[model samples]
Target: MRETAYWLINIACAIVILVLLGVHMGVMHLDAILARLVGTVPEPLAWENMVNRGKSTTQVVLYIVLLGTALFHGFYGLRTMLLEFFSSDRAARVITAGCVTAGGVLFVTGTAVTVVFALNGAG
Candidate 1:
């Protein structure tokens, strides 16, 4: 049951990542394409834009969700790929451990950066 629950959670995360990342990319880059079509200058990708977006509670939360989902999907997918190359149970265990460690480090770093930007305000 526990293993099944965990697998379900990973599947949920993958679905969330797919949906949210699509929304994120559209929101972040659609303006450029729209501006071209409308014959206007698009918003510059500048520090001000970053700071503004980072300062938004909605954007911050969205980014946090994106980061978590992306990391889980990427690391979990990588672990599965790595496992396919190794036949030994011991090798699989080691690969899983390494994936978990790498994922944790990356997640922490990403979360810290998100928090810092959100807290620092316009920088």
Candidate 2:
């Protein structure tokens, strides 16, 4: 049951990653297309636009969410792959611990940076 829950969470994370990355690509990469469609800023990568996004609470939250979901999804998949190769209870425990720790650290750090940037007004 526990393993099933983890698997489901990992799948959900993948879906979140897909949706968030799609938004990211549309905003950051498809600048020309979006400009034509919506008369967006000439350069999505402009410093002014980046600063504006960084100062936006909604953008900060979305960035943190994307960071967390990507980290969790990647780490969980990696843990699964390593377990398949190791195939020992001890190895499984160690892999799980390492992945969890690393993922947690990355998530916290990313969230902090996002919050700080928003608080600082991205100047």
Query: Which model scores highest in lDDT?
Result: 2
Where is model 2 poorest over a 10-residue stretch in terms of lDDT? 40-49
Q: What is candidate 1's lDDT per residue for 68-101, written digit by digit as tens?
A: 8888878878877888899598998898889889
Cand. 2 Cα-lDDT: 0.88
What is the TM-score (0 to 1) of candidate 1?
0.77
What is the Å distance of residue 41 in model 2 from its true position? 3.4
Evaluated against the true structure, the overall lDDT of model 1 is: 0.80
Q: Each candidate's lDDT (Cα)? A: 0.80, 0.88
What total of clashing residue pairs does each candidate reach? 0, 0
Residue 15 lDDT (model 1): 90
